[model samples]
Target: MTDDRVLPRAVLWDMDGTLLDTEPLWGRAMEEFARGIGAEMTPELRNATMGNSSVDALTKVYEAARVPESGRDFEADEDAMVARVLELFATDLRWRPGALSALDLVAGAEIPMVLVTNTVREVTDVMLETLGRDRFVATVCGDEVAAGKPEPHIYRRAAELVGFCASECLAFEDSPVGAAATHAAGVPAIVIPSAIPVPPKPTYTYRETLEGLTLDDLAAVFAAR
Candidate 1:
């Protein structure tokens, strides 16, 4: 609450678990896809898939299912998973608690924001209907980047697309993978963990939820980095 607190040049948001409760839908689709290949998605395997790119996630599923590489058709499996998740998104999507209020707070401040997600563009576009497309000045999808979360590519690209240096932007993430990516990109982040707990990082300030968050809270976290 210092009068001199400075805001970031822009905000970067993580879409799936961070803003929308789409992780379960993605889990359902992953389970179905695993079963199609005669494998089951155990809780451990499903947890590992969270926040990973489609290629990486599907690979994990196949490996956990004990499906040999020769038996895996990555493209077909990913396409099926995305399609199934899209169906669920159309019917089952919901916002995380306090997500709307948080978005409104940032938007009200007139700061630029970008949606940065490991979700593919196809699924992200559908979810945006619920998140409201106008909230973000630009979106960087997993497929658009050379690599996804835990890799730093997506975060870097998102900041670049919005004309900000990575260090000059503040990121919001809910998963360890996403938080790691933001940290690696050199952006300070407010980590609001969802289904899984995120390990602490020097540049990350953790919050229980977005509820009751103020611009002052964001400024304090951003300034700490």
Candidate 2:
């Protein structure tokens, strides 16, 4: 059967787990931070904060680890976490399987791309320098928005930054939280699971990898959805 699906006018890309293999780095920093406080960082703890912002993740960390922290103290702890993670991110950043290739494919197709993520701008600024500022036309960091993932504010802001309605944009995510945020914003989000596998959801489409994906492949998926 012939497919006549309309293509998205733009694309929204998730950083951290999706575009860059920084999930492990974040996990390491979380573990080290816990060590400093005499708290254990377990797999369950990592899972809770895998795709979360400093604010979101730290609350879970403090709760799960039973470490009492005030709001001001929590911010200090977050700063420490970011400092440790940023040190690693400055040197070690690998692309997820097929992420760079897919990015090039989308860029070559001339689709406007926006880097949208729950990561704060301090780390993201470092990444833009390493990944080349030219890769994305716009970026929406979690710190810049009123709320982070699963809230849709950042995705909505990203869509606005790209000058497209959320419906006209395609968001590529690697985690359930990020995917849900894009979906909530009325964007059709495609999830390529990272180290943390996102279960099948009715709101978004799932793919194993972004590698070797073409515009036609994307169009087919969009139409199928």
Candidate 3:
């Protein structure tokens, strides 16, 4: 049977909790890093850090821990945090449920994809080993852009790199920060909440999971825009 639904020009994806179940690993590392700095990682701070760049995440940790700015060594703290997260990633990285199948489904349809994440390139590259570098036409990392998620820069750059206008693309996100970025960029997204709950918005299409998603599901989101 011929497919009647129209597909998007390109698909934009979020990393971390959205595609890879790396949020837990990042959290573990953050918690440990916070402890080392004499700070406890609070739930509120952890949620705030979700979908944020390493710099932003670390800053939040410091504030929550009540570490004075005069005592903070941002570069060193960031490096250590990233290093610890990488160690966990090397042994524990895994895909979210049905993420692999969803990826294959999109690839089989020949829809170009761009990975847009607040993850730094160093850590993102390591995760890419499991995600397969060949799947995406372009990968935009936090370090590569002036700002990360919740800022719209990363999403805007990804769409541009993929040769599509933000309006022509459909984004898949799992966090409020990520959703905000996509919305600000004028990209309609299919939001599947992961580590944190994202508020409902008319501009976003919600799904419980990536399982059983079809081109029609994606097309419906794009067509609505």
Candidate 4:
């Protein structure tokens, strides 16, 4: 099928599951956190809170494990987990399937790519540095914005930093919250499911991943009505 949406001047890419295979690492960290707090971490609970901000995710972990939030010293745990995650990335970090190819395609097209993610600035920097994509035109981290995913502020800020109107940018996301935020910002969003399941239609366009896509591939997808 020919996709005829207007071609975007820039593309906003999600980090974490979209570009790197970090969601499982995050899950492991969360599991460790829950165990450290003597809380029960259930798959259902994880599913419910997948794609949430770190703060929200931690809060859910605490609530689900029946742990007391007060005096729980989440910061220390989070710090330790981040350290471990960094270590894991140092060895295990790799681009998701077809990520490099897709990025190359975009780069070859001379389209400015911005990393827009709900990750904290520090972690986001680490991922970008590790992936060697630190040269992105701009990066908008959830912590840098007043509100995170599911709120359009981050997406709007990213577009602004790239000097593009929301309508002129295309957002690539792997989470419902990210897609919602992009949509709310008036940008066209493409969903690539990772750890989180994609919602049914009437919301966003779903792609397997960026695999098998070239600049021409994207152009064709975006040029369709």
Candidate 5:
């Protein structure tokens, strides 16, 4: 079932937990924010919005704790939290296991790669600079788009920027929101579940992580389809 010649024209990567191991830093920042407002930050609440946008994540936290803060106040708190997280991330960020190898593999195959992330440009830039992958062919930040994950706009935009059709691209993701976005864009997705477990369904493909994947591995995966 291997189709060695059917490699994707482009590979779309998710930045946060997929490429960088920064989810714990994010959780710590969110917990600190909850404590600042005298809210009970429980593991349940954190799990609920593990892969959501900052605004949506905070709104869910507030709703679950029954905190009474106006939208503006919440936004301010979220901004502060994100700033703090970015600071910590900038100092301690490291790419996930085999991430660099995966990137090199794609690059060697001459496959253009795009970063499609829910993180803002500032944070993403820091990550890109740190990892020396700032020269990605395209990037679509969640804040720049009208709708973030669970919507196909970001993926569609990334495809457009890279001059590839959605169907000809392969999306790499670690969250359900990212998977849904890729699916909505009519692209096949290779999921690498992080903190959240991927749903058991027939809609998408799964990989433990990018640890041992090579360019040939990806080409084989796509060719089999």
Candidate 6:
């Protein structure tokens, strides 16, 4: 990403493990789901499924847990996980470091922003309500797309919702799967590692945290792109 000297038309945000410290919440849910399926939540398995969509995560966990991927088990377990997270969200929703401040900075600037997440709407909507129902102009969730992160549909839709193409947007992501989706959407992404460790990737640039992030910082990255 060399200095392209261009400005993004919109900004996109990832929810779980990004704007919110919800990975642990997801972990709790995952553990419950695992136990229900006669599996265990090993660290490796947790890491593997961290940023994935419900189906993808379920499939991976199920495979790793050696659970037969048969019948409606996937959907049933997904609902269980969702239920667990919803219950957690109601009382323990935590914010990621500098998340709200960064959001306020962008919102104050009047740049339209959107929450783009692989999380299903059942959870994302509740998080948005806490973030402030009107904080984002739009939110594109996993359930809205034909495919989730690691696939570009959600990001593409988010960019569209904000009246811009993905190439004209700046996306913030905390997970490699989400980052990959942003990158695939032709959106230059700023990744802030959370819940799961992100291996350094040359395709997308990373920030240490949302703390001290400025619109100028975003433009600098855009310029370099």
RMSD of each: 1.6, 2.2, 1.3, 3.0, 2.4, 3.1
Q: Which regions of candidate 6 are displaced past 4 Å? A: 1-6
lDDT of 3 by residue, 67-163 (tens): 8889889888788888888889888888998899999999999999999999988888888888999999999999898888889899999999988
| Candidates sorted on lDDT, descending | 3, 1, 2, 6, 5, 4
Number of clashes found in candidate 2: 0
Q: What is the lDDT of every predicted structure here? A: 0.89, 0.84, 0.89, 0.78, 0.81, 0.83
- Residue 198 C-alpha lDDT in model 3: 97
Give the backbone clash total of model 4: 5
Q: How accurate is candidate 6 locally (lDDT)?
A: 0.83
What would you estimate as the lDDT of candidate 4?
0.78
Better of 1 and 6 by lDDT: 1
Cα-lDDT of candidate 1: 0.89
How accurate locally is residue 32 in candidate 6, as Cα lDDT from 0 to 100? 78
Query: What TM-score goes with each of the models?
Result: 0.96, 0.93, 0.96, 0.89, 0.91, 0.92
- lDDT tens readout by residue for model 5, 20-84: 89888888888887777667778778777676777777787777667766543765776787789
Backbone clash pairs for candidate 1 read none
Per-residue lDDT for 183 in model 3?
92
Q: Output the lDDT of residue 221, model 1.
A: 79
- Count clashing residue pairs per candidate: 0, 0, 0, 5, 0, 4
The alpha-carbon lDDT assigned to residue 118 of candidate 3 equals 92
Off by over 4 Å in 5: 1-4, 68-74, 201-203
* lDDT minimum window of 10 residues, candidate 6: 67-76
lDDT of 1 by residue, 1-225 (tens): 646878888999998888998888888888888888777788888888899999989989888778888988988877888888888888888889999999999999998989999888888887888899999999999999888989999999988888889988999999889999999999999999989889999989999898898989988976675
Model 3 residue 14 CA deviation in Å: 0.7
Over all chains combined, what TM-score does candidate 5 have? 0.91
